[model samples]
Target: MAETQRFHDRVALQLDDDGVAQLRLSRPDKMNAIDAGMFAGLVAAAEALQAMRGLHAVVLHGEGRAFCAGLDMASFGRMSEGGGVANGLNDLLERTHGLANQPQQVAWAWRELQVPVIAAVHGVAFGGGLQIALGADVRYLAADARMSVMEMHWGLVPDMAGIPLMRELLRSDVARELVFSARIVDAEEACRIGLGTRLCADPLAEALALARGVAGRNPDAVRGAKRLLNQAADGDAASLLMAESVEQAKLIGSANQREAVLAVMEKRAARFQD
Candidate 1:
């Protein structure tokens, strides 16, 4: 294990030699609820990860029983007194982080990361927390985990980049109902509805194992695939087809690709440089 970096005392980031990073929301006593500090910490964590060279994969999880409960009561209390004011910020409509505010950045930053991010969810993921999970490329959820789009209960809406992320994973009606009703969903139902990628008895362990496998692969190829996939949804057929060719051409005869083929033929693990 490398030195664990603390962000605002709310998030812990540990990067291992295998090019995998574990980002834990560290406030377990409060179910890892998103408070003002947590909001800032998450953005900081994402920024730090994006800057880390040779980082192939990331596993995101909470330190305690739950992934995240939701926005903390103190934030709600503060909103009531200050009319949506946050950390001396202007308003929610303000773009604080290039097409995202601070709250949205907590979730959106993971989506913009170059490498794959896997969320290992347990206990409850509500509102903003669920958005954070949705930001990941894959989600491994515990059987007992419960999730909800719970902003309705607070007389608010899913403003933390939840709507766009949910639309990519869920049917329009299911997404609408979840947001409008704010009903609790079990892990089984969440997986069935495309909210969760898979179920695991020990979600964090499963996630770490999977991330290690991803990290063991050709790092450039993995990043290229992620880039193409992220652009697939909104890209035109002709553009995406050309993009695939362009990306493939760049990797087909590369050193990493040659090493990958040699390792497979020799029945050995591929040692990737990046």
Candidate 2:
């Protein structure tokens, strides 16, 4: 399906002229919880972003009082009937989307994007909700926002790749304590512990500003930097250096690159294509 202001009835995506996409979880009535439709919406948004040329960044935020409350209550009801979470999720062991299952993709999709995704977290980001926030390249959390590795309390692991994302951000000991205890962390402590990239009075506004700033840069360079950084943790020094060269080689002397240089000299904004 073509892009629209709203899709799947639960998510909205808007890419402005600045090349910054505003991706919102729109099911406010349910605190934007992850339901079957929400899952599809997230995946569809990510897929659309991947196809959108000249996109530089994304600002992901929730549309209601909370970012997301995690899986819908109905999913928990099904688990209470003595079966795994199989509603639209299928088998937990199946890897439906490369290295992740469909459920994991809801969060992993943001991380997998080549461009930067900044999550503007507010209210509460619980369980799978927190995982989705973590999927972003950076998180700007409101001062009063709350987050948790919430699945443990429900007799499940952080199955939405939250643990894996947390491993990248939090200390091993800290992650263990939070996952095991299912403790909720406020924005202040979350920033101190590295779960939040930044804390502010208004996260969505800050995130959008940051995204627009990034969008103002040469998009090719911005994408190259993100692609390189995404592999830094896993790739060896030699491989990463080569990867950096490969990315730079593609960006050097491109039209946007030349425009960036001329724009600096002329003290004007560089025009980029979409």
lDDT of each: 0.81, 0.79
Which residue pairs come into collision in candidate 2? none
User: Over all chains combined, what TM-score does candidate 2 have?
Assistant: 0.83
Model 2 lowest lDDT segment of ten: 236-245
For model 1, give the RMSD to the true fold: 17.9
Per residue, candidate 1 scores C-alpha lDDT tens digits across 1-274 of 9999999999999999999999999999999998878998999999999999879999999889899998886665544443334344445555677666777789878878999999999999998899899889999999989999987655456767777677779999999999889899999999999999989999999999999999989988999998887786433433322332334334433555455545544568877678
The estimated TM-scores of all candidates read 0.83, 0.83
Best by TM-score: 1
Task: State each model's C-alpha RMSD to the native.
Answer: 17.9, 17.8
